[model samples]
Target: MATATIPGPRMPRAMQTLGWTSRPLPFVERAHAAFGDVFRIKIGRDTFVVLADPADVKQVFTGDPAVYHAGEANIILLPFLGHKSVLLLDDAAHLSQRKLLLPPFHGGKMRRHVGLMREIAEREIAGWPTGVPFAVQPRMQALTLEVIMRIVFGVDEGDPRLARLRTRLTHFLETTATPREMRRLLVNGPIRAERRRIFASLLDPVDAVIAEVIADHRRRDDLADRDDVLSMLLLARHDDGSPMDDAELRDELVTLLVAGHETTATALAWAVERLTRHRAALERLTEEARAGGEEYVDAVIRETLRLRPVLPFVGRRLTQPQTIGGIAMPAGTKVAPSIHLVHRRGDLYPEPMAFRPERWLGVRTNPYTFLPFGGGVRRCLGASFAETELRAVLGVLVSQVRLAPSQPANEHVGRRVITLVPDRGGEVVATRVAPDVAMPSAA
Candidate 1:
């Protein structure tokens, strides 16, 4: 039998929404502290059952994506990601789309893009102003955005349309970075008209740019030999030999542009923030970088994801009867596998708050215990790509220039709609100081 209710804070709806919007991480931690590993939190009209235990997290991740329905769990994002997107699809359709998409992101295709990524990262890092504090997020965003535009959309660097699309998409993101904009779209009422008006205005030109790119790809004969992701997607065949329709193509492209770039930019910024404060780790990382420490670089990225996951949690809406951590839950119940809380648990990670890259050097972490990319069928398709991008970007960043924390105290993660962005935009000072020590093992 299903439990009637779970233990959660019984705060008024208004307060819950306010607390969640203002400070999501602290709110979740408080809930875990007060109610233990399993608890519930109601925000607006929805109730989510949150699981902090790694064992419980495994159940949610290992459960079939069809039953868990990751796309449905993120219905609130349809206004941005769209309906035909692989991100919003479930079960068979999701599998079909993944089959077409996976090939381009793996194998020789990924290897071919590795050098392009390094070039892009180096060029962007070269432009940063030295001896002054600047937010790394903007540069990281620009670097990732340009990389995706070229690699994913097949747009050439000199194209005027690429510049326009970048501006328009950035503007769109700015508007959507608040609670007011979210409520304008998610909630229905008299305000729905306003949301539509604004979204249409923001979306029209961006869609036009994407449409133009798609048309160009369709007309090009040379694309058969090209290996850009969009070209690959254009040529990718379904089981019955049909190509994806324009809407499907456009939606998936937009999803990649947004979903692919945003999380990575935020994560890179967080990495810089963490490194600045953890001087020892930063020094070791610099030594590794100067000495070409690929393993150490990987460790730094791994530790960054562990310490500050750009997305705080992976949520699923229960489709049928399910139990997690011994508590039975009925259908329609929403479950949030708490990534942030899980990473910070004392039992799982000693000195949970410390930033230590050395810890990951020789440890084989249990998949469920360290779920930065989530797990199971719905795991992030861009996981390997994002990690590759981070390593490439950081390789250019640390090897070429040295950075230090501009702020004495740690910067808090602020609410940015769905993403928890670094507060004060991850401010850091750029210095061209050379690393004095070389890691022989890395060399």
Candidate 2:
């Protein structure tokens, strides 16, 4: 019946803050090395109780969602995700919204987007600065955004509205999701208000565009046969036969837009960067794909996600008093399952630092240990959609494009929002393979 203090660095708060913001991976690795599985670290005004052990991670992820409120811990994302966004809801509300949204991104429903993904990737990659070095992350972002707008929103590819909306979205995402912005929002009052004002101004047009799209969908009778997510969402009814309202629909659309695109873009960039560096893996993936199979491609993606998890941490906050990792967690305490550290644990992964896709051959990975998509109730709703996109994009690119790192040095990890991005934006030169060997024309 006693609360035990979590052990961590005795270093000054300033140093901890510095390490967390500037270089999170090394900061976490050092903390876990010094304090073992569970430790405490401060970022801005928050104190995070970090856990890397699989047992602790399972408890945090699989525990009652009522007790561990993912929504509360993600308050920073609320402005971007919107007031009614499913990502910011808890318990019953969260469950209801999730049920409404899951069908479009699940099983067979999600596989329907593969052709869209392949088409987007092919068109975008066709224009890559071939025979010259360029950052592939921007290209990847463009490709994923196009897929989201077309496949998720039902937007026409060449529509002027689509272009205008993309500009606004990129501006909103770039302006808001940064470490400086997060810290300022946490602690700075005046700046935060100014930011809120600017953010509202930026968001208004984007909201308007989404509303127009939803309205247009309502007017159109030809959509019942459509496979796009927006169409499905428009037609979807709850258990009691209620459909999402205009605001709810728009918020969820924005949620899918932001959440669906950037994370996959970052993951794809890392996959390319990793594959180009590891020749054997690259060869195996290419050969496997050429043989009319994607088993090795799946392995490559699995390895990429494990090595460079898009979100460095999966966060949750306690709603009531509970014990985690044998340490007392009072209500309102923040906890982060360190995805970065757990993926690199020597026990879970042999040669944890190396990029070896074969490690997955005939291997069964525990979901808690290999959680790039997270676990349980709050796991990413678009997990299957994202995986399918990655596989489609990777299969196409690996077969048609011959690519390698622009510089001899390895790409360093960089932070954007909460995702780890490739340094210099996964810089590489892409060239076409021989005509006979070019990726089979996008289906």
Candidate 3:
């Protein structure tokens, strides 16, 4: 029997899974067209009551944490993120970890990292091949990874340790993102215990390096003097005056590493992809970049994230029978707020399909309507850090080089694990480079 009372596609679950894996946006859009704002989707053994309306989304985000278990809904990520990860914790545990993790990502701290971001971005942007079509996503990935390595991991660029970990992690992440691996994950959507063990074994190499890093941090006498996230975390004390253990640090560090870099890189790739297609926005952003004004640059990033959100949905599993959108759902039913759907609603955004940065200029968008980072208490912890990275990278990129789309059409979305990435990896051709831009210095 169908677990959901809401109307949705009556297709065989296999067909629904195929559509979701291959063409998520279209699949959701088709359902929304046929079934209006709220719909049901059955994937594997779970039934997700997907919510598209902002009002309904608001209710879910603002709902009592005990009832709407975000962490329980994110259990599939447990193996990759570890059992102690803030992403895998709920209620008080999640809140306590959130408080500890909050300081380093605060607004002032993010600003301190902008110079490093611009330097890394400038160095990477300088090396982009000119007058030839090439995918920018890989380069963006490299750039963001380096940023996370330095700013979050506290690893210096030239260190042998950084090179080793970076190489291993890049391979690990890319391997997991392959179509074969993605399909395997989809088939193992429930992430059974054996599958989790397999996932953990795969992380053994990366975990070895993280263990080394944690040991190094402990040995450092100047931990309190360092501004990097890892250092602050080492020095942070719980409300009970207890320091986080090695296992907790390892889990949190890995969580930040995976979540912090990849998503920002994907967003930057999309920024280049979108800007290259929109001449006016590109020119305005470049001009703003060179003039040291960030208003338009910020707007461009806001619009890009809105249209190409890295993650399509934020999920909360019902802990008890609860009514949402006036429809009751049983315990363990997943209610997903569709970020992709709400961003495209015509009622909320005129010409939502069109890329329009000007729409955000000098406007304070309603939190529910413009939640690219998700909303309420469960909003992404790295939200500000990601935005800061984007602004710095995009600003540095546009100021240094001129980019144009290699293909006439915009790049189509492709699935990468849980993220939606550019199908062609955001292919583009750099036409011009500023002579002043310098290659990365070994310093």
Candidate 4:
């Protein structure tokens, strides 16, 4: 059995209460300072072991899959994502699902989508008049939704159902991230009358759409090799020659669509805000993008990912008793590698918060020290796809528009559901830098 060692000063009830309330960052920061790299905190019945140490993070994240499972950590998402969703699967199931989904996001496949990404980004930015204040999050979300719709469903933005689905899906994700609602649900069971009302409002429409898509696919008996993700999923068969059932297909599709677009959109919006706040970094990014090299643009994207990880924490449940940083944690305890905190560790990143793209130019940091898409078998399947789209989209944005934040810098960080979104919705004034460039393709 693992032994427990209390580290530093015990957390005051005030700080513990704050962890259960609205602001978690302050409690997290306080814990880091008082307890060094690792510590344990209790929020109601959940005891979360937070680790910001690089070695421990790597061990917990990339260690044996059977021992550290994400399915246990992400239980909250299961109701919406379904039991078979990749996020909730582990071991062989995760491996098998990952293999089936790999082809769509492979290097060759991702390169083909660059032109498509560039086109959507350019077209979206063109719609914003010079000096007009606009919300960047919604715009990015729309553009990403369009791209994902085309790739996943092989449908154009003009499809009436697409618009409705986007609206409903966005509302659902936003509702799940509400601090007050989330706290209530965490403390109480999800069966509460109010929680059910909100969840039903968002989920009903999505289920309808998923059912419609499945019905459409079933009607087509002449299904042959097709380019979209749906087609790939349809054609996939297990090693035993059993195909995925309709329920499984629906869960996987919804998971990919939501996970693929939402996080990338949030990351892109945050990247824009960061660039607007730091003029030096923005100028360097602009210059590098204009110069046109894979390495330079990649640097900017990497630095942005490092600074503001889309999914800030990768959670796992300890299957075996373990000690981290001299703190003993028992089996079934919740362990999270605080990616945001780890990325900001002064030891791993010099002047961590400063937006310096040059850090990634030639310098080598520990792989575990910078995990934007996570690590190990459960790593994000859409990571390659997201990177390709982000770099391509940002490349086009920088080349054509100069974006300035419309709100104060300090107020930029806001909470949208679980996502650390821009408080002002990333409101910005965008002016077209080059009118001569043909509007980017929307397909």
Pairs of residues clashing in candidate 4: 177-417, 177-418
Which stretches of candidate 2 lie above 4 Å from their native place? 1-4, 177-198
Task: Return whichever of 1 and 2 wins on TM-score.
Answer: 2
- Compared with the true structure, the alpha-carbon lDDT of candidate 3 equals 0.85
Model 1 clashing residue pairs (backbone): none
Give the Å error, residue 344, model 3: 1.1
**TM-score of structure candidate 3:** 0.94
Weakest ten-residue segment in model 4 by summed lDDT: 1-10
Question: What is the C-alpha lDDT profile of model 2 across 218-335, one tens digit per residue?
Answer: 9889778898888989898878898888888988998998888889999999998998898788888888877768778888989999999999888888888888888887888888
**lDDT (Cα, tens digit) per residue for candidate 1, span 83-113:** 7778878889888888888878874456677
Specify the poorest-scoring 10-residue window by lDDT in model 1.
434-443
Off by over 4 Å in 3: 179-196, 436-443
Q: lDDT by residue for model 3 over 281-376, one digit each (tens)?
A: 998987777667889988998899999999999889888888877787778788899999999999999999999999999998787888888877
Model 3: worst 10 consecutive residues (lDDT sum): 434-443
C-alpha TM-scores of all predictions? 0.93, 0.95, 0.94, 0.88
| lDDT for each residue of candidate 4 in 54-85, tens digit (9 for 90 to 100) | 88887886678888888767666665777678
Question: How displaced is residue 131 in candidate 2, in Å?
Answer: 2.1
